[model samples]
Target: MPVAVITGGGAGMGLAVATVLVADGWRVALLDVNSTVGEAAAASLNSNQIKDGSEAQSLFIRTDVTKYDDLRTAFATVADRWGGNIDFVFANAGIAGGTDFYNDSDSEPQQPSLLVEEICLRGVVFTSHLAMHYMRRNKPAPGGVIVSTASAASIYASPELPLYAAAKHGVLGLMRSMSLQLASEGIRVNSILPGAIRTTLHTKTIWDQFPVGDFTPVEEVVSTVLGLVNDPTATGRAMEISAGETFDRKQPDYCNETMQRIMQGKSY
Candidate 1:
């Protein structure tokens, strides 16, 4: 069976993706910070397998993606259990938004919390780093696919959450840079950009503020992710899923001949 690891797979789009992958017979390992939810998700998937008269097809590892040891051990555990190779990885764990930059209530000036960037940006970077290590083991065959969860805020400005925007933007940069290098080694890299999906990411009150027509469905995002996983040539793409449609937001070409030459290293 094909083996996959999905961080943040306990709930939201991550769990949904795991559900689809499990149904399709992929052996999956879910890495999440919540033990209760992660274990339950794995059990639910395993229960489905039992109904199908097959062995359990899912496992959950309690992983704090921000920590190297936690992620490293989790990756190694998955590789050891399923074999030495991993076929796919979804670096999809994220927090809703960063703390308000100007909202501190203490009399003294306080240092800002970077937990938002740590989880959103650094989590993705850490996940992708270990993903490459195990995916490389698959050769004789082409290396596996790596998909990170980037937000639409990755490209657009979000004045209300500037720090969150910055971290997600970093995810976009990482995906593009990794794809340029990894494609030559037969590994595809891509990202999903979802707009206004209702999950635990935000409160119901917050979600209610957006127009119903403006909401993007989680299923739409899942479809885009699976599209990338199944397509051999779909890499370096930041696909935006909004209002039931999918669009590959294209990056611009160099502005002029001189800049193009410099960009492509044809000029100094």
Candidate 2:
């Protein structure tokens, strides 16, 4: 049986991805700090298994991705349980750094600006490093994959969430570098840049601050993720998932032109 490890699999987009993967015949290991919700979500996926008529092997481990030791232990447990190989890894654990814009003087000092950096940027980096360590040791079962949940903020700068944008940009940089490094191992690493997804993480308080109702369904994002996992040729790619639209992350022509002009010392 193929095994998949999903961080932040307790709720929202993480849970959605776990459910879909389990239904498609993969055993799931859910890693998250929220023990209560994580266990519940794992149990829910086990209960929903069909066709196989047997429950999916699901384990919920309490993990803090910001800590390297915690992530090391979590991966060890999964490797031991599944015989030292993982078919896929979803570094989907992330938090939204609320509406702490630079212009907001009334906002508290301990807002999304610093918090997003710790959780999204540092956390993803630590988790992906551990994932790569384990992945390099295992033999690929036809198709080995690593997918992460980046955001549209990676490309577009959002002044309202400067830190969040910066952190996601870091995720892109991580993916780009890892893709080249991991190619020889046949372990594909990619990211899903979801524009907006209707998940619990987007709470009313958060929505009130940003006030954007447009959201792509969780199913759509999950489908895109699955496609990347199934495609052996896809590596170092980012799939953008938005409502009624999708695209691969590609460099724009203007950026290339601007770079050439800069190299030629041309004025704007």
Candidate 3:
């Protein structure tokens, strides 16, 4: 069976993905900052796996993504339990920046703080770096893939949430770069930009703004994630999921002949 690691896998789309993968014979390790919910979520998934007669066992490790030591320990725990090979990684943990700078009062305008950058951007970078280490040493072949949960803010600027937007944009940039750099080693990197899902991050006020039927289902996001993982030809791709719509976001390929030539010249 293939082994997979998922950050923020205790609830929402991450947990949904874990359930699906577990049913399909994937051993999953869920890493979340919330130990209570994380352990319960893993137990629930394991129950389902047992009921379905799957031999796979799911593990839940308490992890704070902002801490590199926590992330390293989580990865090590997964490796020890499931062996060295990690077929897939979902770097999906994130916190919503609740301040809307554009609509704020004159007292103070909210801005992207260090914590926002640390978890949303830096945390993802750390996870990806560690994933590459284990993926290169994967069993069978070196075919490993990483999928990140960027937001719709990644593609379009979120005036109300500039900090969140900027952090998500950083994730997109990181995903694209890793895709290119790891392609030669059979490791694919991709990101998903989801719009307004009714997760815990969405407050009641925010939920009221959208129509009753407009919330994108978590299952849709999970399905897209599975597709990206199984699609061999997919790499450096950004999938956008919103209410009643799903499509790929096209990005420019900057590595033209001119840039290649310039890089070659610099190689001397």
Best prediction by TM-score: 1
In terms of lDDT, the poorest run of 10 residues in model 3 is 259-268
lDDT of each: 0.90, 0.82, 0.88
TM-score of every model versus the real structure:
0.93, 0.86, 0.90
- Residue 45 alpha-carbon offset, candidate 3, angstroms: 0.8
Clashes of each: 0, 0, 0
User: Which runs in model 2 stand beyond 4 Å of their true positions?
Assistant: 99-113, 140-143, 208-213, 252-268
- Which tens-of-lDDT digit does each residue in 1-268 have in candidate 1? 8899999999999999999999888899999999999999999998886335677599999999999999999999998898778999999999875476768575877777889999999999999999988777784576999999999999999888888899999999999879988888888999999988988888888889999999888898889999999999999999988898888987778798898787555746
Q: Residue 102 deviation, candidate 1, in Å?
A: 2.8
Regions of candidate 3 where Cα sits further than 4 Å from its true position? 50-52, 100-112, 253-268
Q: After superposition, how far is residue 129 of candidate 3 from its true place, in Å?
A: 0.7
lDDT of 2 by residue, 1-268 (tens): 8889999889988888888888878888999989999989988887776557777778899998888888899999999988988888998888874654554465565543466777788878887887787877876433368888889999998877778888899998788668877888888999999987767666776656543547787888888988889898989998888885889986445558778687446788
Candidate 3 per-residue lDDT over residues 1-268, each given as its tens digit: 7889999999988899999999888999999999999999999887774445756589999999999999999999999887788999999998885754456466766653567667788889999999999999887778798999898999897877778888999999999878988999999999999998988776788789889688889888998999999999999999999986898998865578788667435543
Model 1 clash tally? 0
Candidates in order: C-alpha RMSD to true structure = 2.1, 4.8, 2.9
Error of 1 at 59 (Å): 0.4
lDDT, model 1, position 161: 86
